[model samples]
Structures are given as C-alpha cells and as structure tokens.
Target: MEKSPDAFRTISEAAEELDVPQHVLRFWETRFSQIKPMKRAGGRRYYRPADVELLKGIRSLLYREGYTIRGVQKILKEDGASYVAGVGRGEIEPRKREGEMASAPPPGMSKPAPRVKGAKGEAAPAAEAPAQPLLPLGEVRVVVNRLSENHADMLRAALRDLGDARRILDPSQGR
Candidate 1:
C-alpha cells in the first residue's frame, strides 16, 4: 500500500521524492540549518512533511534555477524558512507561471535571469516563478502563446528582448 504524501518520509523517501541523491540530501542537511529531520535510535533520518518541502525549494533554486548554494542560503536567511517553504510549495511563483517552463535542459544549458526592475525604478518581479524550469526558450514560448489580443505587439517586443538577453547570457556563447 502507498503511504500518504503527508506522512513523514525516510531519507530515501525524501531523496526519491525530491529527485536528488541520498548523499545530496545529507550534504544539504550540513549546509542548510533549517532541514532538521527526526532521528531514531540508530541515527536514521525521518523527514517531516515540512522538511521535505524545504528540500524541494532548495533543490529548485540550486539545480533548476541556477542559484549558487550561497545565494540560496542568503534567500533563506533574509526571507526566513517560511519564505523558502513557500517557494518549495509553489506558493511564491516569482517567474514564468507554472506549466510554462520545461522540466529540464541539457547539461550545457543555462538559466535566464528571473528578476528585473521596472522603468519607474521599482523592482519588477520576473514574469512569475518557474514551476518547471528547464531552458530559456521554453519560457519565451510561453510568453508567445499567452499574448493577449490587445498586447500581442507588445508581447512580441518583450519576447524579442528576452531572446537578445538570453543570447548575451548563454554560457557557451561566443561573439
């Protein structure tokens, strides 16, 4: 029988659910003070629902979103555990909306900048957070498909700008 997702998960269970290796989870525990899984008599780990969620968020930021370990650490430190948890829970969609991005990219692919500022000097958030971050073009395609009738021309321009920005940032890029 399958256990409920809400049930506490073991180290293997949490690692499998997060799609990361067990050692990766162990490494993350060392780096992230927030992930405190319960330990039994033999020091076996049993991850709580909340702990798993936090791992999800951290993995997204590090593996998918191209954030450095230190960067994720700063986000957690500045925003607090709840904010990171929100990110993991898909509540803080800060880039292209869910279902718009791809699941993963080839090894050489690079992620685009997720946040930018507005014309008025206000910090503009990215389109929405990436729900399935994979490659840059996937998100551009999303912007294209979602262009409202009234905003078609403007969205086209925006897409063009995105393309240029992506070209400039590609890690393998050569002028």
Candidate 2:
C-alpha cells in the first residue's frame, strides 16, 4: 500500500524520494540546522513533509544549482526554511551569483535594490531580497540562460581588451 503525500516518511523512504543516499540525509541534518526529523526509539528517523521539502530544496541548491554548502546555509539563514521549501516545489527561483548581471533591463522596467535590516534596525542596501519576486522554474531557467549568455559575452569582451593591452605592452608578442 502507498502512503498519502502528507504522510511522514522514514529515512529510507525519504532518501529514495529525494534520490539521495540515507547517509547523505544524515549528513545534511548535521550541516543544516533547519532539518529536524522526528526521532523515535533507537534513534529511528521520520521526516515530516516540510522537512522533506526543505531537504529537497537543499539538494537542488547543492547538486542542480551548484551551490556550495555554505551558500545554501547562508540562503537558509537569510530566507528561512519556508523559502527553501518553495524552491523545492519550484515556486521560488534561486538568486544569481555576484558578477552574473543581465545584459539589460527590459524597456520601461527597473528593479530597485533589496533592503536588509541594518545594525540599528534600519533598512539597508542588500544585493538579494524583495527586489525581485519569487519566480517559477520556467522563468528562473529563462533568466539563468540569459545571464549565462551575457556572462559569456562579457568574458569575451574582457579577453579581447586584455589581448589588446598585452599587445600594446609587448608588440613582439602581438597576435
């Protein structure tokens, strides 16, 4: 018999659902304080639906999105578990890394910078926050692809500039 979607899952079941090893789940619990599976006798683990969702998000960030453990941890700390769970459900998009700028803003549209709480409780400038709405996976993919293309263009331009500078410095080495 199959359990309902809302049912709590054992470690094995959760691991299978997440397509990760049981040991990986255990290791995640150590790295991410947000993952608190209920403990039964002999330390058997049962994962609540939310816990599983959070784990799925962490896995997506680490594996699919290529985020370092520290990056995921920082996301969880700033955005909270619910936000990560949204990411797992494909309801929220991961933010871009530094230096991955979009080529240009759409006409007649501009995004204000996100703000964070300052040391004295005032709103201060922060790179990622409410500046952008949580986007679905399709939109996120579109944005990511555009960023990647633009980043490649930027790198090519930078390389060209470097080559020109090198030629100016050493005419004998010019290509």
Candidate 3:
C-alpha cells in the first residue's frame, strides 16, 4: 500500500523514497546546511513531510540534473524556492528574474581554475575523472571475509571462553 505524504520517515525510509542511499542523505545534511531533521534518542533521524520534499528536490538536482554540491549551494543562496522548483522539474538552469544577469551560465558551469604542472606547462583539466564501476556484492563479500578474518577469529575465541566460564560456574553441569 502507498504511504501518505504526511507520514514521518526514518532516514532509511526517506532515502528509499528519494531513491538515494542513507549515507548520501547524511552527507547532504552536512553540505546543504538547510536540511535539519528532528533526531530521536540514539541518534535516529525522523524527517517531516517538508523534509522529504526537500530531499526529493535535492536528489533531483544532484542525480538527475547533475548539479555539484557547491552549485546547489549557490542556487540556494540566490533563490531558494526557485532552485527547489527547478530541481522538481529535473532542470538545473537558473531563473533570470528582472534585474538579474540574463547571460550568466548555470551554477554548475562555473568551474575551478585548471591546475598547471609548471610555470611553462599547459593547464590540465581541473575536473575529476569519471568514477569507476563498483564491485559486485559477491566480490565485495570475499574481500571483506579476507580482511576481517582476524577480527572474526578473536570474537569467536571470546565467545568460546564465555561458554567455558558458564559451564564451570554451573553446578548442575557434568564435570
């Protein structure tokens, strides 16, 4: 069944509804600075309907329209509501209201200066390289198993010791 829009969501629920990872939502909370969800005990997050709507808008801007984190910040600074509207439509173009610069490029287009190798060297591209594809879960599990074997072994040893101590302390247990 479809959940109502007024439903309050945990961080995981909000992330799933917005089609983003919970870590991404956590990161967004740090970057956007405007996304402030109420926190229950034990650091659990509860998002209101407005918070969910804002997350949806931010997700559209970052994933669909390809806005950088900084670009979204700039858009929010200029016109907060308009930015949300643009994101809802999956468009990153800045609105040119009266008296604003009409010929300016969108916020995402503004890039940092290219890095030069040396005084006489040509400037290299400042943009980061395209990300590589992530490894599959099976491969990741194998890697994790290899990496965590020592920790897992220690935990197993500790559990065995606890079991031995329990048997020794129990008078009814067979010697």
Each prediction's Cα lDDT score?
A: 0.75, 0.79, 0.67
User: lDDT tens digits, residues 56-76, model 3?
Assistant: 777776665556787678777
Reference-based lDDT, residue 2, model 1:
78
TM-score of each: 0.55, 0.57, 0.49
Candidate 3 structure lDDT: 0.67
Residue pairs clashing in model 3 are none
Q: Higher TM-score: candidate 1 or 3?
A: 1
For candidate 2, the per-residue lDDT at 120 reads 79
For TM-score, candidate 1 versus 2, the one ahead is: 2
Model 3: how far residue 167 lies from native, Å: 80
Q: Would you list the rank order by TM-score, best first?
A: 2, 1, 3
Query: Best candidate per TM-score, number?
Result: 2
CA lDDT of 114 in candidate 2? 46
Q: How high is the lDDT of residue 154 in model 3? A: 56
Count clashing residue pairs in model 3: 0
Q: For residues 71-118, could you state the per-residue lDDT of candidate 1 as single tens digits? A: 788888888777777888889853322322333342347465344556
Off by over 4 Å in 2: 99-175
